[model samples]
Target: MQTTSTYKILVVDDDPDIVEMLHYNLTREGYHVAQAGNGKTAIEEAQAFKPDIILLDVMMPVLDGIAACRQLRDISEFRHTHIIFLTARSEEFSEVAAFEAGADDFLTKPIKPRALLSRLAAFKRRDAQQDEISNVIEIAGLRIDRTSFAVYKGDSKITLPKKEFELLSFLAATPNKVFSREELLHNIWGSDVYVIARTVDVHIRKVREKIGEENIRTIKGVGYKFNTD
Candidate 1:
């Protein structure tokens, strides 16, 4: 139901030029925009701006993007917020670290404005689709609540990053039905977003860590299933 005009975006980068470019482009697209010069400031700005989407830079003074992302994810209010990392580092480890820190997406700069815009549009479509799905699923002792974007294992609360939570929720929704990694990638990340199949495995592992490994069963070479038995 939220329109482009109402959707807030926070662009955080140490480089003034990058921040300026992103601000101009996002504002031109009718998105309400805010900017921060570093990760530390980004967190403070996020508290006040309350952006639906955040474009964060990796290398920064005061605090790094990965640390900032981890800190942000710990905050209950921002748990479901979209965080995309924009970094010059294209190394595989950097990408893995970014995801581990709870980033929703990773982009290497020099940023292509058009591609970034397309990704943002894809996120908007995904959000709309998410709104149409069932909001909660309870299985065994686990409860996945999409309404608050929170999960509960019996009376104990478990906090999972956005992608991990989605992966768990999607599988748990279908009980014992097994879903391939490709199917999970398409369903959770969407077909428009380019991410390797391994990303699913990473998220699956993280989800298991929070909710317990026994809840999700890996079917040899086939894929993963939520164990209802």
Candidate 2:
């Protein structure tokens, strides 16, 4: 429902060229843009700017993007914010590390301006669609509230990163029905986001750690399902 001009974007990278390029491109698209030269500054700017999207570089001085992202994910105010990792490293381990640190999307630089914009547009479309879905789901003594992006297990509240929470909620909504990793990837992250299948396993493991292993079941080769019985 909101226009591009209403969206706030934070571009965090150590390179001045990268920051300037991203700022120019994003601003040209009518998005409100801010820049940070390192991870520490990025965090400070994020607190004040409250950007809806962050393009964070993996390698930076002071704090690194992975650490910065983990810290940001801990803040309740940024629970739903989209954090995309940008790195020149295309190694599998780097990709895995980014996802584990709470990154929603990973892009290897030599950044493609058009692809980046498309990813942001996809996120906007997904958000609009999510707005129409039911806000809360209660199952097996756990409460998943989409409106507040909160999850409660009985009287205690559990903190889960964005992707973990979405994976949990999606499975819980259709209790006892099995869903493959590919299916879940398409539904939760959307077809526009590029992430490996192992990313699903990482999120599932994290969710189970917080909410208990009994709630979600692995159906051997079939994928995963929420246990209702």
Candidate 3:
């Protein structure tokens, strides 16, 4: 459903040179590209352009990338838009923070143009494959819609950011089946990602906060399972 020609991307950074370089590379790859010099302008451009992906710089003026990412995550319209934090910082804490703020991926600065192209291509392929799969899963008292990226509890809709929703949906897809943390990290975060295995706990806690803790049961020294029984 997503063609390279129609795929839109927004590159947000404080440096005009970086923005221009990114714009050039992305456009050359057949993507419609937009540029924003700050997080605030990035938000405005995102709202207006409705880009499918956003390459966000971590350090910026007016508003920082982490804050902007959190803000965007709160809005349902940007729920499924892929966000990758592009930063010079390679610290583990920085990566964890980005994920907590709702980034889909993190890329270190000075990224090779070829690497960026490969990553974007992979995402596009995954998205296309996802479209062919069932987007709605209904069980217990919840309805998870992958297409609209929404979750409904009975008649009320409960808003969850991207990662939380994906984790919940993955668990609910196989009710009562326990999944280990390593398995979760591999499946949800992708095996190539460098997130700590313990990061799963943070996301799990957030999911429990939104939904009832009773729904997701944790096994000591094991993993977690969706209790539909």
In terms of TM-score, the best-performing candidate is: 2
lDDT (0 to 1) per candidate: 0.88, 0.90, 0.85
Give the TM-score comparing model 2 with the true structure, all chains together: 0.95
Query: How do the predictions measure up, each by TM-score?
Result: 0.93, 0.95, 0.91
lDDT of 1 by residue, 31-148 (tens): 9999999889999999999999999988889998999999999888898899999888553445667787888887779999999999999899988877777667888798889866
- Give the distance in Å from residue 153's predicted Cα in candidate 3 to where it truly belongs: 1.7
Q: Which stretches of candidate 2 lie over 4 Å from their true place?
A: 89-93
**Cα distance off (Å), candidate 2, residue 178:** 0.6
The number of the candidate with the highest lDDT is: 2
Please identify which of the two predictions, 1 or 3, would achieve the higher TM-score against the true structure.
1
Candidate 1: global Cα-lDDT?
0.88
Show the lowest summed lDDT stretch of 10 residues, model 3.
89-98
Residue 67's lDDT within candidate 3 is 94
Which sections of candidate 1 miss by over 4 Å? Answer: 89-93
User: Mind giving the per-residue lDDT tens digits that candidate 3 earns over 65-129?
Assistant: 99999999878799778898888855444666887888888778786788788778767876786
Indicate whether candidate 1 or candidate 2 has the larger TM-score: 2
Rank the candidate models, highest TM-score first.
2, 1, 3
Q: Return whichever of 2 and 3 wins on TM-score.
A: 2
**lDDT string, candidate 2, 91-153, tens digits:** 344667888888999777899999999999999998787777767998999999976668999
